[model samples]
Target: MPWLATAVTTVGLLSTGAAHADTFVPLPGGEISRTLGDGTVVTVRLVGESATISPSMGATPVHRNAWVSGRAEVQVAGGIKKGSIQPGYVVGCQVDIAGGGVDGGASGKTDWEGNASGGLTSGGNLSLGPGEATSFVILDRESANDYGDESHSSANSFKGSEASVTWADSTIGLSGCAGYAQARAFVKVKVQTETIRTVVTLWGQPFSLG
Candidate 1:
């Protein structure tokens, strides 16, 4: 369905941190905000052109549609939260949209209607160790079915694991594994309401290549 472009604006502070240190941009009194709570809307003004939109979480690039008539309110965050803007958030960027609705190679795909604008924060991560297998379940609280969505699991032990994520409006999931040495296996995941999807990461010594 097509949506009407809703303009919004707010005041906020835009800070930039260094890779090895903490930095600040001080986006004070700029008429642009990046921390709009749930249900809060804001507007954004593009300079004679539209900008790319996508969750700034990790490496996940989920795309969506949003039009910034003048500005947009920062609504949701991926996982971390601090005031309106998280520790790693940019102002004037709340909703997550594809770059000009063109082929910007966004992580996730979505539909659009009015001008597309917004920001995104990516959540959910998966990792596997050598000769390791795992499983994951997906759930949606807004649905009657406890398993509102599909589940995923890793069958064969693998030397590594690969992660692939997909999302709709507010729903996201992932699949794929790495280093499976031709082993037979089956994995299952269940989605239910009140799903507390946490990030799974494996930490260990680096593998050497001969």
Candidate 2:
């Protein structure tokens, strides 16, 4: 009887572990690298992420809220294939964060902040309130690339490697809120080249505001 009980417990443990094995676990701070077909390599890394209590933007010191911030670093090599004609790509990296929180104060009870980052252009962006945001310069682009597309411009170009970016969002805070948060870093380019056309995605560890 004792041996049978032990075997049943082992089976239960194994079942629980198998259920979580396929879960997508995010890293708090890590690096991911990808090489494209033509001969381009891009690496995106997050040094760290933090949350703090700061004064409200328009309100007085009487108000407190969560401020989320992170440092994004990138390393790129062999990403250009310039020519007289043919197709070319301007490759670079971008940083983004997706998360939600709840405020304890008179502010909105539910806070959901998504896609807040300067994507491959103007370096990076700090978190704006809910709908409004600003672009923060982390790794500056050497020169704005123009692929002769009207709808697109150089403002969204992170054309070089070895660039650094720092971003902070006042609205996506937890001073008076608590919930979940996620940080993501990815590579972006105007057009896909023979090389440089792969899905480059990396995620940081999730955050909890208590």
Candidate 3:
């Protein structure tokens, strides 16, 4: 929970900027539980979700900016021993994402290959036209690989029955979209037992970005 505490402190610092042209929106975080073929239960939850929307720095309708924060928690049962948690967001421009899930390859998880990277950059800066959407992991963790070279990953691996990841004031900047925009959060957890592996995803409620 040390990371969570750090995130809390960051949130406090970020929230102080609310005096500007920022619109604070509270999100109704969600939870989902899935049972694997081997009867292993995996549960994922998104909590303390929120967004602070700000006017475009460019002073144009085609630009938007937001600061998002949330915590993703995972619980595994039925003798599951390990798993990985991937937390991300999907953003849409003049498109409906409230129904959950995006098509046309707009829905994808971050690869764990260390060197692999997602479509959106670590800063969450994106440019999309109308009816376009994209997904990106929020974490950009850096470490040394087996060869002692630099590596990056978006997911956190965990052992035992429970694990959680917290993020605060993550930026989401969009441009080149003339219409309304929206975004939603997702937490994907992959749980593995000695003989079985399963993945469960939890989606948060979509909210307007404009």
List candidate 1 stretches off by more than 4 Å: 1-20, 28-71, 74-105, 111-147, 150-210
What TM-score fits each model?
Answer: 0.17, 0.39, 0.85
Output the lDDT of residue 127, model 3.
94
The 10-residue segment of model 1 with minimum total lDDT is 182-191
Clashes of 2: 14
How big is the positional error of residue 119 in model 1, measured in Å on the Cα after superposition?
Answer: 17
RMSD of each: 20.8, 19.0, 3.7
User: Whose TM-score is higher: candidate 1's or candidate 2's?
Assistant: 2
Q: Write the per-residue lDDT of candidate 2 for residues 48-147, one digit (tens) a residue.
A: 4544433343244222234344555555576443201000011111212342121111111111111112343332222323232222222222332376
Residue-level error in angstroms, candidate 2, position 4: 64
Which model scores highest in lDDT?
A: 3
Ranking by TM-score: 3, 2, 1
> Which has the better lDDT: candidate 1, or candidate 3?
3
TM-score of 2: 0.39
